[model samples]
Target: MKKSISKVLLAAVTSAVMLSSCSKTPDESRYIPKTAGVVVDLNAKQLTTKLVTNGITMDKLFEATQSKDTSNEVMKAWKDAENSGIDMQSHFFASFVFQGQPAEHKSYISLTASLKDADKFEAYLKKNIANFSLKTQNDFKYIWEEKQHAVIGWNKSAVIYISAVDPSNLEKYNPGGSSSPDYGDPSEPMIDSATAVTDSAMAIPAALTTAEDDAQIKTWVAEVDHLFHLKKDETAGSIEPFAKLLKEDADAGIFVNPEAIYNSGQFTMIPANVKKLMEGSFYTGTVNFENGKIVFNGHSYMGKELAAIYKKYGKKEIDMDMLNKYPSQNITGFISYAFDFRMIGDIVKATGMDGMVNLMMGKSGLSMDDVLNAFEGQLTYVASDFAITKKESPYFPGEFTEKPDAKWIFSLKVGNKDAFNKIMTSPMLKEVFTREGDHYTVVNPMAAATMPAMSINEKFVTLGSDSALLQEYLGGKGHIKLPDGIEGKIKGSMLGGYVDLEKVTAVIPEDKMDEDEKPVAKKAKELLKDVTFVSKADGGDVQHGEAVLTFKNKDQNSLVQLINLGTEAAKVMQARKAKEKAYEDSLFAAPVDTTVVAPQ
Candidate 1:
């Protein structure tokens, strides 16, 4: 079974590679079934252009990685197909579609690619058909079993390979599912009819209501018949929402419908909590590349219930000026988000989770609002600096300098000092912390030695690994210093962070890395040495976020650096793997002593 599946996989890979090398662009919508749960569209020409611009062309990469000795027939055939007069400029489209309902659900994966020369492509498949476990029916060739089913077909300039699955059969492959014999009688009722009904009125529990096995089996059979007998131009039904997204020109993009999954009833046993969350939201995301970053923007449209909840709580703008207090120039990165604590209480009150929260608060002799109001709801996290410190080794003989530890500081503005003070001076904190002036340190034997000590000032509290760093912050010397153009990035953002890649990468000591890892790390360090990232997000009618990577040398932008870095990293990894393989071969090839020694 494994070997058969492997052959199918090999054929699929070869088909994709061969089709990718073709130049003809066929109508993508023809092969796309309307019932598709996800649709992926690839603009091969655009992607190839981008990759070539960055010195990481896919064709060259594949040629470079091709094995020298093609001892395997399947591989040799594939190489021939690739080398054959095929155009390598075309778009590719793939779709995942469901054909049946729950209990006996089935799915199909369809791939469509354009062919430069239909005659040559067909000949290639015919020559290599035996390499896969395939059977012929008319013009189509198919491979089907308990685990997987696949179909391959072509028409003129269009080529398609589809892999389908009967999800009901997956139970046979599930290792964790119960294999025990079923002692329950098939005729037994799911619920006692006498107790379930009274005077012709029937009451059914949610768990007891289920489609009978026989009914599900019939549905599965019907679906299978329909699938096998599908017309060449039959419309499976299009998910228009996702199809519309494809209209936007992009190098590549994907669309998924969670609501469709929820409605399928195929996996009806979704958790209650997740069901509520899923039913309360609709989401879609799009991808596009900018000058430096691969842009991803998404929207979560709340259902009536969730939307009402958001409308009740409202939103607030965070003051970026507050960010000036933290030592920005000294810190590698910092993330700060502002919220109104009362809004959280309001949300909990509006939502149904307040009952449990109130119960827990009552047990602690506190009100829910009081607990929520302890902090001002403005939170800042500072990753100031890092150090590679040596420690005793447990696995090896000598101590080795491990990875760097980021010096982090967390500051929270206090709204109610009285409430916070009471909690801070509680018996629990007294047991864990020892006070000196306005600061406290962990004196507990169980606490990690690296745990930060904390200090409290009027209307503010700060915690840091180093007391001096916290002092610097209190003295206003630890505030983040925004770069010249950074103000523009953070202007309307509710939450933002700045990452100094140069400083962060400088802390990564390549000299301390293992011999095999040093080269890879060195390449990464060199590539990212001048890159810095600033990301910001805003909350309103439509939530928006943007992250931009800035380079010291304008010529070496994020996209170019990323491509070059990936190329170099791949080379390093390939070299390391080759070296490891050679070592293994040498060990295995060592001559064995065949001489029998005389007994003493």
Candidate 2:
């Protein structure tokens, strides 16, 4: 009975050990602070798999980039990293933290990654880097690179790198304070020299020296250590949306705190009212690499004020009728958007900047309301029939050169006829445009020669590169037929865009291209198919969007295609450089024309 009990206990212990070994480790993102203004997470394992599947090994990439020198520091570091015991299969995180008062603002850049063997990494660093030393404090070991103002710290599980600027040094350079510089005008109050000097003196700090740098490095080291010991609540993982984005199995993910970034000292020149607009807003996005296309999915959460405004106006779908009226069937590209113009007025008023905006426009006898109310908020810009034609050079008579030409139409739906008339008749525009029936024309000869034909009415205001095309559009003589896929995306979207890269490339004069540019252009044409983007309000305060870049080969991954293109481009560039070098060498080797004619 005792022998049987011992065998069962040993078996249970073996099973527990196996279970522990098989469990997955946590990502490095848990170490990033919630206050980080921006965070970027890279799925190293996913990226590596994609590259490998695409036949893009690091050795091949280095070869393509002409990094043949093994002695290169970057190469050496990369080789060392391979053996450093860092977990290359886990997610890596980079974060930017913006904190502190405007007068003494601090910015911290942090990079975090999981570790397999901390001691091996330390040894690798010491072997590859000069003047490297490690210090121990509590639970973590750290090293500071004084010149870079960066501190690298690590424990048994993960490594963190923190770098920051000394705010004192920033204060020394920006002695005029965070406020905008006073550009004195007769209408505005002038700041006397004595007052200016006092303000500048107060804003400026003592000069920065080696001692201050040392202190800053020490602070960074503590910051690194603190990051390693952060509580779960203090981490970015606590942000619900950001955490969800990380779990979406994307190739990469990004999170941005607009309020924190805009409030940073770097943007001190921005008006307080403008900065308030970004408060409480955050943005998150995910990037995925799939077969045939690369996609970016994004979401924006607006502030309370902005959300209220958005909710009030709601979303306006793009007008298919207006887009269909475009005069050409061979359309190359287009950008269509539907939004309520009144939202701009509301936002300006909400930010309490309407008074200043009206004050600036008062000189022209126009108000912000007059400008915002004139548009119905649906706009479409279409370019078609792109071609490269030989035209007589304006500067050199009788000389012809290739010039790109395309027919384009820019149309905007009219909201209120009276408001539109008010803007057209405003003091600033009255002298520039002349009314002919329901349409307007440029009064200046130079402007008329360059500007497209414009027609305005209660329904729409349209500008066309060709007058006939403009008349046809107004008369409803043409119809635009978009691809079913593109039409479906744009039909109900608040914002949508499409570009036919293949068509654009077909119009280029390949004969005119330089020797070095031809191969790259050819490769690009072979790889690129088309690009499309669409965005819409998800609901309430959130906006969701996607942009896709599709490639020609549907079987291969888009990333692989891109890598192949890059490698081909690199080869072309190297050949060009070699040829140029040969020419240069031949020039040097050739004997000088010493037996030249006495007179030219």
Candidate 3:
């Protein structure tokens, strides 16, 4: 009867152990420290779903990339990941943490993930790694790879991997001192191992030489411990904006702390005052892969002082009338911006650097105010009618070559005409350009021939590549009608840009391209459609921006299209290489003419 009781007790203990190992872990974001300089989060379930929906699998990817070796370590590891006992559907987080002082500074990288079965994970590691061992310390178990300067620690439900460099291996932080090592002359005799050791002993302090190898390992283990034991308030989830960004159901998200990054010891050259200004500033961004396009949305939050400056100046709207006046109706691309120039002067004065700027400008008979006041802070650059055509070479007359040509115009709204005239007629610029009626003309004949025509007036200053186009614009005889998709976005944005990829690809001159290049160009033209971006200030301290890269296929996911394009391009490259090799081999295999010839 006693023997039967012993057997039952053992079985109960085994069951408890199994149950503990299978418990679910907390959210991955909880392991990221609030002060982490940079954090990248990946929603594995969303990514996997998208891949599966697109008919993309690991085996397919390997085949596409032409990886036929199944016995390789990478392939073996990938196969093991299928049932490695780690939760594949949960989120994964990678974070960068900067800690310690300048003298003993250390940067730590940590990757946190959930576990499905701890015992199975351990077994998986043992099977993959040679001579692997697990060491238990306090409340968790860990593995230290001394050569890799990394440590992996795990609890019952989660795993954390931390890697850091030993501070002793880094050079001592000596202010205003040269730290370059003395390698001596390369021609000098090599030292024996005994001599080298003796010299090293003399050069390095005893304390450094005697430091334990496991000191960095201990620190990394401590970091792992801290991650697993973080309080609710200490995690990145506590940051309101970052938390909201993650909750937006994005495939991936990123959070950056500029204050923490600039204040780190690695950036010691940044002034303390500048670092202070960066305090409380952070940025959050999200990425989504959608049908026909990839979209990126981001928000930037400024600190109190910067926010005050921005609010004081307020936001400026782009001058649609000025942009509409662009002479080209077939524009391939354009970028427009609206911002108050005076805000730059205000910021310089606030930072106490205006005096130095004015002193430098005083030599040119101009003040910082004169330069900043010349523009009303609205500008547009447009490029249209891109073409590749054959033209006679200037250096070698009658020799024709293919060259790319485009019509481009750049214009800026005039703020104070008097300030503009003062800058234009300054001693520095007066020698190169001469005032001609209502505009300025290049004085040098060579420059006049190559440079674009410049026209200036009280309302606007414009430069154009074609003389007729410039005259048409100045006469108000031309008006631009933007595409419907781009017009809506550009009209509502303070900063806007558009690129017509179809127009660009149409002018590539595919008939003149090499056989290998033709396929890639054709694929690119089929895959790309257009690109557009919009950015605006949200009235307070927050700013928002978004960009979209659209593809030709409206029904397929952009990620899948990109993968297919990459695979096809790789195949073309492989074929090209094989063709070149065959030609080389043919030359070597040809029979040589062995007939003897008499000298003449």
State the lDDT at 385 in candidate 3. 88
Ranking by lDDT: 2, 3, 1
lDDT of 2 by residue, 96-210 (tens): 8887754553677777777889888778656533345668999988766443346778889887877664333444323254532332221111122223323433343323336
Each model's lDDT: 0.52, 0.71, 0.70
Highest lDDT: give the candidate number.
2
lDDT of 3 by residue, 348-419 (tens): 876677889999888688999998899999998888888887899889999998888888888899998999
True-vs-predicted CA distance for residue 275, candidate 3, Å: 2.2
Q: How well does model 1 score by local distance difference test?
A: 0.52
Which candidate number has the best TM-score?
2
So what's the TM-score on candidate 2?
A: 0.83
Model 3 residue 523 lDDT? 87
Clashes of each: 15, 0, 0
TM-score per candidate, chains pooled: 0.67, 0.83, 0.82
Residue 589, candidate 1: how far off, in angstroms? 6.1
